[model samples]
Target: MNAYTLLPFIVLIAAMFLMTRSAKKKQQQAANMRNEMQPGSGVRTIGGMYATVKEVNEDTVLLDAGPGVDLLFAKNAIGAVLTDEEYNRIVHGIEHDLKSDAGLVPDDASSLTESDESDGSAAATADDKIDLGKKDSAEHGADAIQAAEDKAAAAEAKAEDESKKTDGDSDAK
Candidate 1:
């Protein structure tokens, strides 16, 4: 085959090789992080359990999940070594403002009363802003549940009537 015919095949092979190499590099980095695990380091496991490293061994690591709660995990189950900042944030329940421009209500707005006015629109309360979407969804869910109950009751009543009719007919015979 001519070079023109083999060009696409070569490009595909090159892309695959690059992807494999990148994945291997990432795996090596994760392995390095696991190897660097030491006592007192905050680590999150692959199972999403956050714990402090109490002890490290060749094949297993003891983790302190909480007060009076220590568990053992395989060395390879360690997902990430948490930084001091991350660990502190998790422990203190601190949230980072990742989406400041997402048009979310501020924490202060949660305490607003119905009489509170904003942007010269007294009709728009905090409840109106938050409950507009949820109200429709909740109403629809309740309607569906009620309809289902009504259908089930109708079916049960029909079955009972059929049974009574059958019993009357058997007695006549």
Candidate 2:
């Protein structure tokens, strides 16, 4: 066999080895995490159910889903072991000592919009601008509905005229 043919096989074997190695490492980590689960520890199952670990057996776990709700789950079914803060925030709706959001970035692009001082020229000519199918709002709500109805009526009338013209042309032909 040529070296070129062996190269592909070598690459395939290397890839499979690396993938299996990582998968084994992940399994080991999961096993360690599952073994570390103690009573009162918060856990999320593979099915996305959040609960508190009430008991840890050899291959099974007793989870306290809620008050008077004990659910038995396999150790492999536990997806994540959550921190107290995360568990409390999700389950009990308790917020930890969070810093003020003033320093954080805004969630939307509203802050990026041009301010009045940046572009007042557009605002000055806004009233004189022709409509470009922009919906009216606030005080123009009724006017917007009326405009929409008028526009639809005009479209229907135009379609009727076109149909009439087409029929007349057909007769001529």
Candidate 3:
């Protein structure tokens, strides 16, 4: 009824408007991320299930869920990139051979895979510096894999040296 009373109402309305605007911005960001997604990228859905993108169309994606099964979902339904366990599970369950089935693999798959793989190989070759252990390999594991191989080789050489030393001690005794 008075100006002071109207002031509180106006403030409340402004706060609600700001909150909605923030939500819309976040939604737009997520949509943009999904639109840019290509095949071979790991994705999680709004329902929390993770899948590897088998194909991407204008408004939908064909996701491999395993056991010869694939799921078709709207582009906007994807929540985010999947973690290591999720990607492995999805890949392991795929019944159709992605490499063999030319139709199954999306056109973008090769380029995306090549780009991601090249980046990884380049990074690995550039540095034996990083540990690249299990934790560092959540998204893609190729770099971590090379690191693991190096670690294993180092361990084996150490073990062999220890065995030879023990053999020499026994012979001397």
TM-scores for all candidates: the values are: 0.54, 0.57, 0.46
Residues 1-173, model 3: lDDT tens digits: 88997998999999999999999999998988888788888888999887788999999899987769899998878999765455665656644445666655465643443445545875555555657554655666887888899999999999999877756567778
- How far out, in Å, is residue 87 in model 1? 0.6
Off by over 4 Å in 1: 94-173
Q: Best-fitting candidate, measured by lDDT?
A: 2
| Cα distance off (Å), candidate 2, residue 93 | 2.2
For all candidates, the clash counts are: 0, 0, 2
**Per-residue lDDT of 81 in model 2:** 97
- Model 3 residue 73 distance off true place after TM-score fit, in angstroms: 1.2
Better of 1 and 3 by lDDT: 1
Residue pairs that clash (backbone atoms under 3 angstroms), model 1: none
Model 2, which residues run further than 4 Å from truth?
Answer: 101-173
Off by over 4 Å in 3: 83-173
- How high a TM-score does candidate 1 get? 0.54
What is the lDDT, from 0 to 100, of the residue 122 in candidate 2?
Answer: 51
Residue by residue across 1-173, what tens digits does model 2's lDDT show? Answer: 89998999999999999999999999999999999999999999999999999999999999999889999999999999999999999999887766855566788854555366756755565557677887668878999889899999999999999877756567778
